[model samples]
Target: MSIQDFFIFNCLEEKDLPLLHRWFQEPHVKKWWPVPKEKEDFFDSYLKRIHSTEISLYFVSYGNIPIGFLQAYPVDRSKETWLPKLPKNTIGIDQFIGEIDFVGKGYGTSFIKKFIDQLLAENNEMTVILDPDPRNKAAIRCYEKVGFVRVGIFPRKGDLALLMRYN
Candidate 1:
């Protein structure tokens, strides 16, 4: 389905923490997004990090149902010291379908493309990027469907990921 027909991006809020935490605990989400090892302090750390960072966290809703979480950040504002050289207006994104029921559907590609449309509309010259685990074939294909090309592989915390970019 087309994005306008269903998908909506909503900025995250404190009230969504419990829902976010529950999603993170799901096997599908936990496999990809391993939050703090200390589950007891996950919310504490998450709140501090989200509030203090220069990133935007959003929930992807499909037909009024929240099904996923997405986060975007400017590469230059990142705390990572090993980030490769990126364009001046590069925006990086990471996302996952938090709701298991939504997995394998066409929502991911459509939602991401729509989000990119919004970003590019705001700044047509800006670049969009993402790093997905090399083994994540599904994610790689979804990104490719959205017009992002694989730049190269990059090491992130001892794990290798493919750096995909869209201009």
Candidate 2:
């Protein structure tokens, strides 16, 4: 069941840092999302103290209750280094259901559907992508339900990931 039947992507702000920090510490999140421990380091994990223009961060909420975090970024063709060549208009996503109580209750798929729908509505031709740890079956399943197609495995963040692109 969904919580309050609402899925919103609230613009992230400094005020949400504490909540964000707490989410990073959740065991479920820690299992897949290896993030910094300390608040300062954790903030850094968000990149340039959340000032990066490359990504858009959001607080996913069910009704008025914050349930998770989601971030989207465009692959910068100019800033080359690693990363397999992707579509020039590709948009990558990273997200987690922060509220432990909300895990595995179908909300992840619901939120993702709404979020991706919005992104496509904005730019239907824009390619959306996500790379989940090869072992994160739950996440992979959720993503698949939302229309992501398997694109093979690749090294990502010190581990192999099943890079999937929206199709």
Candidate 3:
């Protein structure tokens, strides 16, 4: 099936926390997202911030089956020192395909492109940014396919990342 046919995006709800917690424990996801060792602590923290005005989080579905998570926030709202250097209206994005079966299937590129398109439509002046691990060659390539150009490499939370932008 085509990517568009399978993908659906919905606002994340409090009821979804358990599933998200499970996804966080997955080896593939844990490698990038430093989810807290204690599930309750992680859930509490996420619940507190999920409703922030500066952030938006969504659940990614494929033909009604939830398969991933995506989130976006104003770059300036980030605690990372380097993010404020981006344009004023820039939005930073973070996402992961939670379902193991969905990896390497080209779904990420399709869903990310659609999500960015939606974000831009909602706020015409906004610029989108992403910082993926430099070692994740597949993710970097997917971002490139969706028009994100690597601006530089930078440190985030003590780890190196490839800073990419789409305007």
Candidate 4:
């Protein structure tokens, strides 16, 4: 399905809390990024992070259903615990489909493309970065299909990820 038909990009808001927690706890997402967070803690942290000028969080909605989360950030300014270093002024994405049933459906790829399209519309000259685990072949292929080129590998904190970019 086309992005305009299946998905909507929106700023994360208070009313989205329940869905956010559900997304956080999904087995698919938790398998990759585990956290033992209570609902309030998660909400507070999400709010605090998104309020920073260097980051923007978007809730990925598919026909009014909260299906995933996406974030764009200036890599140089992030105090996030695990992000890799990138060239100054470059932005990167962190995204996932929290619904297990949606896995392998190619929705994540569409989300990346549509979100970047919207971002580039706002700033046509933006450079975008992505780092997916070297083992996630599907993700790597999908990113390449969306025009991001693999640049190099960066191993951070025992995890090795393939860094890719679109300029």
Candidate 5:
């Protein structure tokens, strides 16, 4: 079964952090974001804020078995590190398929596509933005396939990426 088969957004709970930590240690995650060395630190310090931010929302799902993590935040409200002048209330999504076995099953793409559609519906004036590493060509292609356009590049602390906008 795919994420499309049973995709719903739910808030991240205390019990969910164990699974999230497992996902973080997976090979797929390390390949994409390889800085954090400890899972305890990530959750205690970072994941605690999943519920507070109105502009940023996170979901925990059992995508055919609940083995992934997904998060979306307003472009203006979340990480102001690498985006251009976003539309007034625009939201940006940053997600990952941590289960290596689930990597190429179209789950990640389907989840984001559906989620973005819902976000846009709510904030019609918003523009969704993303910045995928230019080195990761496959990801760039996937974003383009879903109607995101390469807007420009912005440099972050460690990596520089191709900024994309979905309007």
Candidate 6:
């Protein structure tokens, strides 16, 4: 199905935290998006920054049902060393399909493409970036399918990551 067939991006809300926490606990998701050992701790820390001006958090929905999480922030606001090489208006993204049933279904590529299209439409001068673990071949392939090019690998938070850009 096209993105229009089953996708809507909506602002994350407090009510969504429980499902989000469950997603975080999933082995596949936790490997990439590590959270606190306690769910409450994770909720406390994440909720505190959900509405930050420096970033935007979204829930990816399929026919109005939330299925995933996505976030975007200015590259300059990031602590990653490689982000400084990009233009100041560059934005970085992080995303995951929270619903296990949706994994490997090609929704990620469509969602990312549509989301980036919207971002570009809203800000003509902005560039978008994504950093996924190089070991995650599936994710790398997905990003490549959405027009993201591999720029290079960089160390981020004690791990090496593959940096991809869509401009």
Q: How far out, in Å, is residue 157 in model 6?
A: 2.2
Model 6: weakest 10-residue lDDT segment is: 76-85
Say which prediction, candidate 1 or candidate 4, comes out ahead on lDDT: 1
Worst 10 residues of 2 by lDDT: 75-84
Model 3 TM-score, all chains together: 0.92
Which candidate leads in TM-score?
6
Best by lDDT: 3
Query: Each candidate's TM vs. the true structure?
Result: 0.91, 0.90, 0.92, 0.83, 0.84, 0.93
lDDT of 3 by residue, 1-167 (tens): 56776678888888999999999989889888888899889889789867777788899998899999999987775567865376788888999999999988888888999899888989889989999999988788889998999899987677788999984
Tens digits of per-residue lDDT for model 5, 79-104: 57455566676666777776677677
Better of 2 and 4 by lDDT: 2
Runs in model 2 deviating more than 4 A are: 1-5, 44-49, 77-82
**For candidate 2, lDDT tens digit of each residue in 24-95?**
898999899878768788776664646778789999999888999999988775663346788789998999
**What residue runs in model 6 are displaced by over 4 Å at the alpha carbon?**
none
Error of 6 at 32 (Å): 1.3
Cα lDDT tens digits for candidate 1, 115-137: 99999989998999998888888
- Taking all chains together, the TM-score of candidate 4 against the true structure is 0.83
Worst 10 residues of 4 by lDDT: 77-86
Q: Candidate 6: global Cα-lDDT?
A: 0.86
Residue pairs in candidate 1 whose N, alpha carbon or C atoms collide under 3 angstroms: none
* Candidate 4: residue pairs that collide: none
Q: State residue 74's C-alpha deviation in candidate 5, in Å.
A: 1.8
lDDT tens digits, residue span 80-104, model 4: 3455555565788988888777778
